[model samples]
Target chain A: MDYFIELFFSGLTRGSIYALIALGYTMVYGIIGLINFAHGEIYMIGAFTALIVSTVLTIYGFPLLAVIVLTALAAVIWAASYGYTIERLAYRPLRSAPRLSPLISAIGMSIFLQNYVLLAQTSDFQPFPALIPEFDFMEPYAHIVGSSDLAILVVSAIVMILLTFMIKFTRTGKAMRATAQDRKMAMLVGINVDNVISITFITGSALAAIGGLLIASHIGQINFYIGFIAGIKAFTAAVLGGIGSIPGAVLGSFILGLTEAFATGYVSSDYEDVFAFSLLVLILIFKPAGLLGKATVEKV
Target chain B: MIFSKRMLSILAAFALAAGIASNASAAETIKIGVAGAHSGDLASYGIPTMKAALLVAQDLNEQGGINGVKVEVLAEDDVCKPEVATNTATKLVSENVNVVIGHICSGATKAALPIYRDANIIVMSPSATNPDLTQSGDYPNFYRTIASDDAQARTLVDFATDTLKVGKIAVIHDKGDYGKGLAEFVKSFLEKDGKAEVVLFEGVTPGAVDYSAVVQKIRRSGADAVIYGGYHPEASKIVSQMRKKRMKTMFLAPDGVKDDTFINVTGKNAEGVYASGPADVSKNPLTKKFRDKFMATEGAEPGAFFDNGVTAALALTNAIAKAGTDSAAIAKVLHTETADTPFGAVKFDETGEPIGIGFVVYQVKDGKFVTVQ
Candidate 1:
C-alpha cells in the first residue's frame, strides 16, 4: 500500500508531464494534421531558456520568487515564439502539399533545432535550479512525495483544468474544434481557420514550455537531448490516447505513466519499457482508434 | 592533352621541391596529437583532458623545446566513439605526430589500439581505465596515468567490507561494458573475500525516467549499501530517488560519479553518499601549482582527470626528450624508466599500467566530496 501509493504519485507526476507535452502533439495534429515533430525541440528550448534566464536573473540579484516567475515567463514566451515560427515557416508552406512533405519537414525541423541549440549552448548536461521551495514539514513525508513532485502535480492539474475550461467555453475553442473536424467546412463557415490553427500552436507550445520547466526542475538537469526522450514518450501518450483528442492525450499519459511505474516497481526496471510498448500494442490492436478515440469514416 | 610533356615535367619539379621543403620544416617541430571526445556525450571528460594536454605542451614549449625540438599539439574529436576513434587515429597517423595523448574512453582506446600499433604511434591515455586495454598485451605503446577499472573495483570491494562494514549488499550496473564489467568484477572480488553477501546483482536500463522499482527491490533485499557502477547522471538520479523514498541506504559511487556534476545534480540528497576513486594528487605541490595557474587563467577547475592528463603529457615529453624521434626508443623508456610527474615519480609495469596507483573512499558533505579514507 504505501509502496503502491508512492508509485502512483510518481506515475502521476510523470504522467502529468507527458500529458502536457502530448497536448502539443495532439493539438497540432488536430488542427493541421501534421505531427509537429519539432514540438519536442521547442520543449528543450524552453528548458534552456529557463536555465539561462534564471541564471542571469539570479546573477543580477533577483529574489528567488522573482527569478522563478521570470524564468517561467521567459521560457513560455520564447517557446511560444518558436512554435509560432515553426508552424508559419515550415508547416504553413506545406499545408497544401502531400501529407508526407510536412512530416519530413517536421523531422528536419526537429534536427535543425536540436543542433542549433547544441551549437548555441552546449552538449553537456546543465543542472537546473530547484525552483520550488523546500518545506521542512514535507521532509517527514518526503519519501512518499517530495516538494518538487507535489508542485508538478498541482501546477499541471491547474493547467489542465484551465485548458479544459477554455476549450469548452471559449469562441476560439469552438473555432479550433470546427477547424479540426473539417478544415474546408470551418473555413467556409468564416472560422478564420488559419488564426485558430496558430492559436492552437501557441496554447500547445505554452503548455509544453510549462512541462519543460516542471520536468527540468524535477529532474535537476537539462540538456539538448532530454527533449528527444520526453517527446517520444509524450508522442506515444498522444497516440495511445487517440491522436487529435485533448482529453484523450491526458488520459493516455496517465495510463502509460502508471503502467511504467507499476511495471518498474513490481517486475524489473529493465522490462519497464518492454511492458509499456507491449501494453500500447495490445491497446491499439483491440481499440484501433485508441481508448477514447472516435471512429473516422474515410470517403472512398 | 591538357598536360603536355614540358608542363608535366615542370609540375613534377615543383611538387618535389615543395615536398622537400615541408619535410625540413616538419623535422624542426615534434607534433603531439590529442584525440578524444571533444564533443558529444563524454565531452566533459575528453575536452578537459585535451585542454590539459595542450596546456602542458604550451608550458613545455615555453620552458624551451624538449630536446631542442619545439612541440606542437594537434587535437581531433573522436566523439567518444570507437569507429570515430579509429578514424581519428588514422588522421593522426597521417599527420605523423611524434606521440598521441588520448582516446580517453576505454572503448575508443581499445578500438584505436591496432591502428596506433600498426603505425608505431604511442598512445598515453590520461583516463581510460579499463583493465583490458593494458591486460590484452597486444599493444605495447598504450599507457595511462590512472589505475584500471579492476583496481577501482578491488578498492571499492575493500571499502565495502572494511569501511562501510556492511555484511549484505546489492550491486547494480547500468549494463554498459564499463559499468557491467566493473560491477561484476566487484561482485566477484567481494565474494572471494568472504566478507559480505551480495543479496541482489542486477542490471538496470539507464535513461529510464523512473527507477522506483529497482529501489523497491533493493529495499526489500534489505541491503546495507548499494554499490553502483555507472556514470553520475544515472547515479545521481538513482540516489535522489532512493532518498525521495526516504531510504537511507548507503550508495557508493565509483570514479564515474566522483565529479562535481554528480554533487550538483543530487544536491542535498547527496549527503552521506560515498564515492570511490584513484587517490587524489591535487594536493601535490606541482599539481597544486598547475591547478592554481589553470584556475586563474582558465576560469574553471581542470577537473580530476586533468592532472592525470598533465602527468601523461609529462611522461611522454620525458621519454621524447630521452629518445629523439624514435618511437621504439620512447616506448622502451616508457616501459622501463621512471618518469617524474605531478603525480610523483611514476613507473609502469611491462603492461604499461601504473604500478603504484591507489584508490580512496570519499563521502559527500555539504555538497562537496570529502575524503573519508
Candidate 2:
C-alpha cells in the first residue's frame, strides 16, 4: 500500500510536467489546427535559455529567487521568439498549400533547430544549477514518500490552478476559445484572429517555459536533445486528454505519469513505455476521442 | 562546318583541362577518413573525437609532415547508426582515404569494419568498447584504445559483490549495444559468484524522462542494489525517479554514467552511486596536465571521454612518428609499438587492440566523483 502510494505520487508529479508541456501543444493545435512539431524544440530552447541565464546569474552571486525569475523571463522571451519565428518562416508560407506541406515543414524545422542547437552548443550535457532550494517536506513520511516528490506535486498543482484561472477568466483566453471554435466566424465577428493565435502561442509557450524551468531545476543538467522525448510524451498527454481541451490535457498527463510510475514500481521498467503507449492505443481504439476529449465527426 | 568543328575542339579541351586539375589536387593530399556520431545524442563524444583528430593533423604538419606529404583528415557524421556507418565507410572508400579513425559506437564500428577491411584502410576507434569488435574474426584493422565493456563490467560486479556486499541485485540496461552488453556481462559475473541473486533484469529506452515503473519494481523486488549499464542522461533520470519514490537501494553503473553530467542531472540524488570505468583521470600525470589545460582553455573540465580522445590522438601521433609517413607502414608500427599514453602505457595485442588497460571503481559523494578501492 505504501509502495502504491509512493508510485501514485511519483506518477502524478511526472504527469504534471507532461500536462504543462501538453497544454502548449493542445492550445496551439486548438487555435491553428496545426500540430506544431517544432514546439518541442521551443521547449528545449526555453530550457537552454533558462540554463544559461541561471548559470550567469549564479556566477554573479544573485539570490536563488532572483536567478529563477530572470531565468524564467529569459526562457519566455526566447521561447516566444522561437515560436513566432517558426510560425512565420515555416508555417505561414505553407498556410495555403496542402496540410501535409506545413506538417512536413514543421518536422523539418524541428530537425533544423535540433542541429542548430547541437552545432552551437557542441552536443555536451551542461549542468543547470538548481534554482529551487532543497527542503525536506515529507520527512515524517520518509519511508513512504520523499521531499522532491512532494515538491514536484505541490509546485505542479499550483501552476495548473493558476493556468486554469487564466484560461477561464482572462480576455485573451476568450479570444483564443473564439478563434479555436471557428477561425472564419471569429474573423467575421471582428476578432483579430492572427493576434489571438499569436497570443495563444505566447501563452502556451510561457507555460512551456515555466515547465522548462521546473524541469531544469529538477534535473540538474540539460542538453540540446532533452526536449524530444518529453515533447513526445506531452503530445501523448494532449492526445490522451482530448487534444485541444485544456483540462483534458492535464488529466491525461496525470494519468500517463501515474501509470508510468506504477508500472515501473510494480512491473518491469522496460515495459513502462510499452504500457503507456499501449494505453494510448487502447484509449484511441475504444474512446476514439480520449478520456476527456470530445469526439468530432470528420467531414466526408 | 569549320566553325562548328572549332567550337567542339574548344569545349573538349576545357573539359580535359578541368579533369586534370581535379586529379592533380586529389593526388597532392592524403585524406584520412574519420567517422563518428557528429550530429546525434552522442555527438558530445564524436565532436571532441573529431577535434582531437584535427589537432593531431595540425601537430603533425608543424613537425614537417607525414612522410614529406601533408595529411588531411576528412570527417563524416555517422550519427551512431549502423546503416549510416556503412554508408560513411563506403563514401570514405570511394574518396580513397588511406586510413580512418571513427564509428565511435561499438555497433556502428562493427557495421563499418567489413567495409574498411575490404577497402584495406585501417580503422581505429577512440571510444568503441565492445569486446566483440576485435574478437569477431572479421576485423583486422579495427582498434580501440579504451578497455572493453567486459572489463568495466567485471570491475562493477566485483565492487557490488565484494566491496558493497550487495546480496540482491537488479540490473537495468538502455537496450543499446553498450548498455545491454555491459549489463549481460555484469549479470553473468554476479551469477557466477552465487553471493548475489538477480531479482530483476530489464531494458529501458534511451532519453526517457521518467523511470518510476522500473525504480518501483526494483524497490519491490527486495534488491539491495541496482546496476544500470547506460549513459548519464537516462541514469540521472532513473536516480531522480528513485529519489522521488524514496527507494534507498544503492545504484551502480559502468563508465558510461561516470560523467559529472550524472551528478548535475540527478543533483543530490546522485550521491552514493558507484561507477566503474578506466581510471584514466586519476592514474596518469599526462591526463592531469591535459585536464588542467582543458579547464584553462574551455572554462570547464572536459567531459568523461575527453581523455579517451587525447589518448587516441597520442596513439595516432606516435604511430605516425614511428612509421615516418607511410600509412601501411604506420599500421605495422602500431602493431609493434607499446608506449605510455595519457591513460598510461598502451600496447596492442595481435588483433590490434590495447592489451592491459584495467577498470577502476568510483562513487559519487557530495556531487563529486571519488575513487573507491
Candidate 3:
C-alpha cells in the first residue's frame, strides 16, 4: 500500500507536467481548430530559455528562488513571443486554405523549430540548475511521501489550480470560450475574435512555459529534443480528457499520469505508454467524445 | 558544319583535361571511409568517435603524413540504421576508399559488413560489442577494438555470483539486438556452472519512464538481484523507480548501462548499483591522462566508449604506419600486425576479434562510478 501511494504521487507529478503542456494543445485546438503542432517546440524553447537564464544567474551567485523566477519570466516571455509569431506567420495565411494545409504548416513549423534549436544548441544535453530546494520531507513520512515526488506534485497542482481559476473567472477567458464555440457568431457579436484567439495562444504558451520550467527543474537538465515526446504525451492527455475542454485536459492529464504510474508499478515500466495509449484508444472507441467532451454532429 | 567542328573540339579538350586531373589526384591521396550515426539518437556516441578519428588523421598528417602519403578521411552519416549503413558502404566503395572505420552499433555494423566484404574494403569498429561480428567467420578485414558482449556477460556473471554472492537473479533486456544478446549470454553463463539461478527473464522497451510492474515481478519472484542489459536512460529510470518503491533488491547492469548518464538521471538512487564493464577511466594511467585532458578541455568527463574510439583510431594509424602507402597493404598489416594501444597491447586473433581484452566490475558511489574489482 505504501508502494502504491509512492507510485501515485510520482504519477501525479508527471501527470501535472502533461496537464500543463496539454492545456496549450487544447486551447489552440479550441480557438483555431488547428492542432498547433509547433506548441511542443515552444515548450522546448521555454526550457532552453530557463536553462540559459538560470545558468547565467548561478554564475553570478544568485539565490535559487531568484534564479528560478528570472528563468521562468524569460521562458514565459520567449514562449509567448514564439506563440504569437507562429500564429501570425505560419497559420494565419492558411486560414482560408483547406484544413489540411494549416495542419501541414504547423508540422512544418514544428520541424523548423526543432532543427533551428538543434543547429543553435548543438543537440547536447545541457545540465540545468535545480531551482527548487531538495528537502527531505519523506524522512518523517517515509511511508507516504518522497521529497522529490511531493515537490513535483505540489508544483504541478498549484499551476493547474491557477490555470483553472484563470479560465473560469477572467473576461479574456469568456472571450476565448465565445470564439471557440462559434468564430463567425463571435465576430458578428463584436467579440473581436482575432484578438481573443491571439490572447488564447499567448495564455496557453505562457502556461506551457511554466510547464517547461517545472519539467526542466524536475528533470534537472534540458536538451533540444526534450519537447518532442513530452508534446506527444500531452497531446494524448488532451485527447484523453476531451480536447477543447480546459478542466478536461487537467482531468485527462491526471488520468494518463496515474495510469502510467500504475503501469510502471504493477506491470513492466516499458509497457507504461502501451497502457495509457491503449486506454485512450479504448475510451475513444466507446465514448467517441472523451469523458467530458461533447459529441459534435457534422452537418451533412 | 564548321561551327559544329569548333564546339566538338572544345568539348573533347575539356573531357581529356578532367580525366587526366582525376587520375593524378586519386593516386596522391588515400581515402578512408568512416560511417556512423551523425544525426540521430546514437549521435552522442557516433559523433565523438568520428571526431576522434578525424583528430587521429590530423595528428598523422602533422607528423610527416602516412609513409609520406596524405591520408584523407571521408565521413558518411549512417544514422545507426542498417539499410543506411549498407548504402553508405556501397557509396564508399564507389568512391574507392582504402578502408572504413565504423558503423558503431552492432546491428548497423553487421548489416554493412557484407557490402564491405564484397567490396574488399577493410572495416573496423571502435565500439561494436556483439560477438557475432567476428564469430560468423566470413570476413577477415572486420575488426572491433572493444570487448564483445560475450566477454562482458561472462565478467558480469562471475562478479554477480562470486563476488556479490547473488544467487537468485532477475534478468531484463531492452529487446534490441545488443540488449537481448547480452541478457541471453549472461543468463546462459550464469546457469552454465550450476551456480546462479535466473528467477525471471523478460524484455522491456527502451526509453520508458516507469518500471513498477517489472520491479514488482522481480520482488515477488524472490530474486535478490536484478540484471539489466540496456542503455543508461532506461537503467536510470528503472533504478529510480525501484528506489521510489523502496525495493531493496540489488541492481546489476552491463556495459551499455555503465555511462555517467545513469547516475545523472538516477541521482542518489543510482548509489550501490553494480555495473560490470571496461575498467573505470581513473583505473589506468593512459585513461587517467585522457580523462584529465578531456575534463580540462571539454569541461565534461568522457563517455564510457570514448577510450574505445581513441584506441580504435590508434590501431588504424599504427596499421597505416606499418603498411606504408597502399590501403590494401594497410588492410593486410592490420590483419597480421600487433601494436600497443591505450587499452594495452592490441592484437587481433585470426577471426579479427581482439584478444585478451578485459572487463571490470564497478559500483556507483556518491554519484560517481568507483571501481570495485
Candidate 4:
C-alpha cells in the first residue's frame, strides 16, 4: 500500500535522527555512567553552526558538494568543541562528587546552553536552506521517496557501521570499553579513563551534530529550543533500547519512529506521542534492563 | 557653612514635595502594557508588534501627547505561555495600566482575558485570532486588530471554491487554540454552504517534524486543495514534505502562513501556495510613511503582523484620547465609535469583532508573496 510505504520512508528518516541522538545518550551513559543531558544542546548548536557555515558558503558561491562537506565538517568540529568544553567544565569537576551531581550539572548545562543560543541568535524559526540536491535515480519515485530521506538512511547506516567497527577494533575504542566496564580498574590498568571519556563525548557530540544537520535540512526550520523535546525523545529511545547499549539505542529509535509514524497513519495523529511513551512504559514493565541491556551485579 | 537641622529638614521636604508633584504629573500619562513573547520563540511576532506599539507611542508623544497625556508603553515578555501571560497581565494591572495591547498568542490571551475583564482593562490584541476572544462575550473589554479565526474561513472559502475550483477539501490543523479554531471555522463554513465536501479532516501535533502520514491521506482522499490552519513553521514543513511526497494538490492557508519566512523555509516548493488574510494594509496610502519609519527602527522588512501591531496601538491611543485613561470609558468609546488607523477606519460589531472586514488572498509567485485577490 502507498500508505504503508509512505509511513515506512518517513519512519526511517525520523528514526535515524532519533537513533543518532540516542547514540549520544547511550555513549555517555555507557562511559561515564552520567547521562549527558546537554547532548541535545550540542546538536542544536551544531545545526546553528552548519547553518552559518552553509549560508556563508552559498554567499561565496561554492559548489553544492563542497559546501555540504565543509558545512558538516564545521558543524562536527564546533559541536565536538562544545562537547569537550561541557564535559570538562560541567561534568569533570563533579565526576567524583556524587552520581546525582554530574546529572544535575548536565541538566543545568543544557538549560544554560539553550539560553545562551537564545541570546546569540534570533528566537524566530529561521529557515534552513535545502542543502542536499535531488538525485537522478529518485526522479521518478519522488512521490514515494526523497533524496534527503535516502541521505539520512545511508549516512546514518554508515555512521553506525563505522561506530560499531571502531568500538570493536580500535585502540581508543578498547580503552573506551575498558573505561565503561570499570573506570577504576581501567585507570589502574593505564587505560587513561578521563581521555577515554573525553573521546566518547567528542564522538557522541559529532554524531549528534550530524543528526542536527540532517534533520535541519529535512525539516528546513531551526530554533533555539528544539533540543529539549528532541533530547527527551532520544532519552526515551536510549531507555527503550537499553541504556548504555549502542546498537540497542538505534533499534529503539527505529522502533519509536515506526510506532509514531504508523500510529499517526492508522489510528490518529493526536495519540502519536501517547503511543511512543506508552510503549516505553510497557517495555520497562516487561524488561527492566531494556531490550538489549544486561542486568549488572553490584561489585563489593 | 552648615545649615541648621530644621533648615535642612525643611529643604529636604521642599525638594521631596516638588519631586512628588512632578511625578504626579508624569503619572497622568496613560500606560499601555504590550504583553507578548518578547524574549522567546515567538519574539519574531512579538518584537514587531511591540515595535509598532513603541513607534505609535513615540509619534504620539512627539505631537505633545494624546488628550494632554503622554503615552507610556511597557512591553512584558509572556513567553507565549498561559501562566506567564496571566502573570504579565497581573504585573500590568499592578503598574496601573489602563490598556493592554497584546499577549499575541491565542492561548496567552485566553489565560489573561479574565484578569483584564474583571479589572476593566481594555486589551486590543494585535495578532490573537481565536474567535473565542470576542465571541464568548466573557471579555467585553477585549478587542483585536486582526479578524477572528472565523473570519479566516470567510476569507478562504470564496477563494478556495471559485478561484481555485477546489471541490473536495482537506482541512488540517495543529490542534492549538488558533489553528484548530480556524480549521473548525473553515469546515463549518464549507459544510454550511454544501458547495465543497471536506474529504479528510485531521489534527496534527505542531512542532513535529513529520507530516508524511497526513500528506499521504490527502493524496489518497483525492482532495484537490489542502488548507493548513497553523503558523508558518509547521506549514513550511508540511508544504515541503507534501511536495516531496508528490502530492499535486494545491495548498491554501490562512493568514498564519502568510509570512515571508514560509517561502524561505519551503524554498522553490513554495511557489503557487495560496494564503488568505484580512486586507493587505501595506497597499493602503497611509502605510508608506509608517513602513519607512518602521524599517528604520526594526532593522528589517515588516512582518505580516506588523500592521496588526500598529492598528492595535492606534485603536488604544484614539480611544484613550477620546475617553481618557479609564479602561471602562475607553471600552465605551471603542464600542460606540471607530478608530482611524493607517490600515483604515476600524469599527467593532456588537460582539466587539471588527466590522466591515475585507479579506484577500495572495499566491507565492517567483519566490514572492504577490496578491492575487
Query: Taking the tens digit of each residue's C-alpha lDDT, what string does model 3 give over A239-280?
Result: 999988778888999999889878866776557778999999
TM score of chain A per candidate = 0.97, 0.94, 0.94, 0.98
lDDT of 4: 0.85
Which model is ahead, 1 or 3, in terms of lDDT?
Answer: 1
Which residue segments of model 4 deviate by more than 4 Å?
Answer: B1-146, B282-355
Candidate 3 residue lDDT tens string, B1-373:
9999999999989977866776577689767688888888888878777766666677678887777877788899999999898898888876777778887999899999999888777888988877788888877779888887698888888888899898899898888888888899988988886788998887875543234456556666788898898877667767765776577889989878888777775777889999987654456665565556566667886764677776777777788678754557866676677766668777777777776456888899998888898
Clashing pairs in 4: none
C-alpha lDDT (0 to 100) for residue B237 of candidate 1 = 79
Q: Model 2 has how many clashing residue pairs?
A: 5
Which runs in model 2 stand beyond 4 Å of their true positions?
A142-148, A155-170, A298-300, B1-148, B241-248, B263-271, B281-356, B365-370
Q: What TM-score does candidate 3 reach?
A: 0.69
Per-residue CA lDDT of candidate 4, range B1-373, in tens?
Answer: 3568889999999978876775575468878889998887778888888888898999999999996678898889999999999999988876667688897999999999899888778888888888788888888887888777677787788789887777999998899877888888899999998889998788888777567766776787889998888889888888889888777789999888988888877888899999986676667754776678887876789875778788888888888888887767887888788887766888776677766455678899999888897
Q: B1-373 in candidate 2: lDDT tens per residue?
A: 9999999999999978876775576567656677999997989878777766675576567777666667788999999999899999998877777678877888899999998888777777888987888777678787787777687887888888888998999999999988998899988988887889989899987876656556666777899999998899888878876775567899999889988867766777889988876664565787776666666656775764567776766676678657654557877877787666677777677776776556888899888999898
lDDT of 1 by residue, B234-291 (tens): 8987897788778989998688999888888788888998888767776788788778
Candidate 2 lDDT at A83 equals 83
Q: Which prediction has more favorable TM-score, 1 or 2?
A: 1
Cα lDDT for residue A14, candidate 1: 72
Model 1 lDDT tens row, A70-169: 9999999999999989889998889899999999999999999999999998877777888887779888878777788788778767887888787779
Candidate closest to the true structure, highest TM-score: 4
Clashes of each: 0, 5, 8, 0
Q: Which stretches of candidate 3 lie over 4 Å from their true place?
A: A1-7, A140-145, B1-146, B199-205, B208-224, B240-250, B260-274, B279-355, B363-370
Q: Write down the DockQ of candidate 2.
A: 0.32
